[model samples]
Target: MAYQIFFREYFQTPPLTRAYTTACFLTSLAVHLDILSPYRLYFHPTLIMENLQLWRLITPFFYFGDFSLNYLFSMLFTYRCCRMLEEESFRGRPADFLYLIILGCVIALFFAWFLLLPFLGQSLTTMFVYIWARRNPYVQMGFFGLFVFRAPYLPWVMVALSVLFDGDLETELIGILIGHAYFYFEDVFPYVPGGWRLLATPRIFKLLFDGELENSDYHPPAEERPAGFNLGAQEEQANQQQRNEEN
Candidate 1:
């Protein structure tokens, strides 16, 4: 019972966020256990093309290099932002959230394959963070309680911090651009003249993830009435009095 409560409280992440974080942690564990090699997971066109190792396309977004302070920070940030976006913005819309992830992955893979970039996990994380930050632009956030800023600047701050850590700016920049493009089309451009939703999640996907097309009719279950209330008896007495008056 305690374990169930604990899980319901702390580990009750949205489905997509939970799955993504679990994949990252499992991949990291495999690497730490020497069961998997990071070299085999990185995105390399030559290896993928000639060797036909297509898994490279997906694996690169699971491993965040060897375990270290940077890796831990990246993982935590990814999990937090992804959870926030899924729960707050994409509430009760798992298919829409999944579509966003698919879009981001496709864009990241494009850069990795064409530009010969090796890894993209951080970039994908940044993309999620950027979108979430943009959606909540007026919200104030702080970095380890050191520097406070509005939500929209959070992604740029991460880029600057990445440079400080000697990380590649290209990956982060790609993520930011892709995130901005998605935000513009999905949230902004739809209001423009002759513009329509370009990132619609298919009806099939909606059915699969969300179970039904309409959620506006949702209602909370009523609480059980306390024992010995006897409202039925009171109603019966009132009805009897009304009949007597009518007679």
Candidate 2:
């Protein structure tokens, strides 16, 4: 009963975040215990295509190198950022968020094939941070409680920190590219004259996850465009719909 309460509080709601973070933690534990090796977990394009080691495609996104202090930091950041994105921007829209994850994974794998970067779990984390930052541009972020900065700069700040600490820059650079590319198409381009939302979440995803809002935002009106970045493009409209349903 006590354990149930604890879990209900700590890991309650934001089901996707709970699942992802749990997978990351368990994968790290398995590696630390020698039950699984990092070698088998990395994304190897050649091995995947030639040898049919297809698990590598998804496995690498849940691993953040060998377990260590760096691993701890990366895992914590991923959980916090991912949960915030789900709770705020992706609120009540699990399918759309899942679509983002799937799209991001495909794009990551494409880059991995070209660049031959083996591991990319941390890269996904950085990309999530980028999107969250972009969405919550005005929110203040504190680092180790040492300093505060507006949210939009968070991804760049992390890239700078990674370089400062002799951390690998390739993963972060790739993440930034992926995040910004998605942001442009999803948020920015749709407002342009004669432009449409490029990656509208498919109806199948809605059936599986949302069960409503099949074509949530083919194009948002101009009046709402200004607040879309921070509050999520569909959030207000969704909330109003929910209220209307209740009324």
Candidate 3:
């Protein structure tokens, strides 16, 4: 099954399709095998032991931690994010998607080595991608057999909850820093007005995503959005202003 999912021809294209399919397959396998519980120990005691090996790069990603409802939600959430990014052409680019995974792995490696931090698995990274791209708040998803409105602050709310309650989940939190850096470096850095420095200091996420560049931010301005300058909106405002002038 692993061989079929990873190497099959039908799973080749559409980056998100490929990713979500792979994640789902892994999650299913982990659940069925019941190895999920033992795998999560990589982030805690087993990881700290001497002579850490290279396979740890992909180990945390398999950390199911628990087979409970919360873990299922994480799996579904990751699939949703993978589908979303796969829908985007930029993310579909083979080089770019590969770059993102590589970028994520590098960040994980840095944290594990220099900081003595526990390796965060990919769960937070998936959530971060979903949150950053969630421009629309009207979306909904079923939770525990009940439908719920998508809250705009869900991502931050998750972050706060994780911080307050997930003292044991160090890898998930620190993993987001890596995810943010990966996304910002790949997608946001290229468009910045004078961000050529990113090429020189590619790994310095603080300079890239932080407030250091607000004065030079180059994102498209508000008035230029499709909704902002629609004929109806502008024309109505213009007529209202003209009527006031006449009065």
Q: Name the runs in model 2 displaced over 4 angstroms.
A: 1-6, 213-215, 218-247
lDDT of 3 by residue, 1-247 (tens): 9789856754554654566456645755775687454444354434545547545656655554455555565555566565555554234243444445556656666666665554344444543454344432344443456446454445544455456645335555555566555445544555456643252223333244332533332233443222223435545765788799999
Give the per-residue lDDT digits (tens) of candidate 1, residues 46-89.
88889999999899899987788778878987999999989877
- Comparing 1 with 3 on lDDT, the higher-scoring candidate is 1
Q: How much is 112 displaced in model 2, in angstroms? A: 0.7
lDDT by residue for model 2 (1-247), tens: 9999978866674899888988888998899899999999988878888999999999989887667667777887798899998997788889888988888888988898899888787788888998888766656678889899988888888788778766668988888888888888887887767978788888878887888864665454454343354355455665787799999
The residue ranges of model 3 lying beyond 4 angstroms of the native Cα positions read: 1-52, 89-91, 114-119, 123-152, 160-169, 186-188, 197-247
Clashing pairs in 1: none
Q: Estimate each model's TM-score.
A: 0.81, 0.85, 0.55
Order of models, best lDDT first: 2, 1, 3
Overall local distance difference test of candidate 2: 0.81
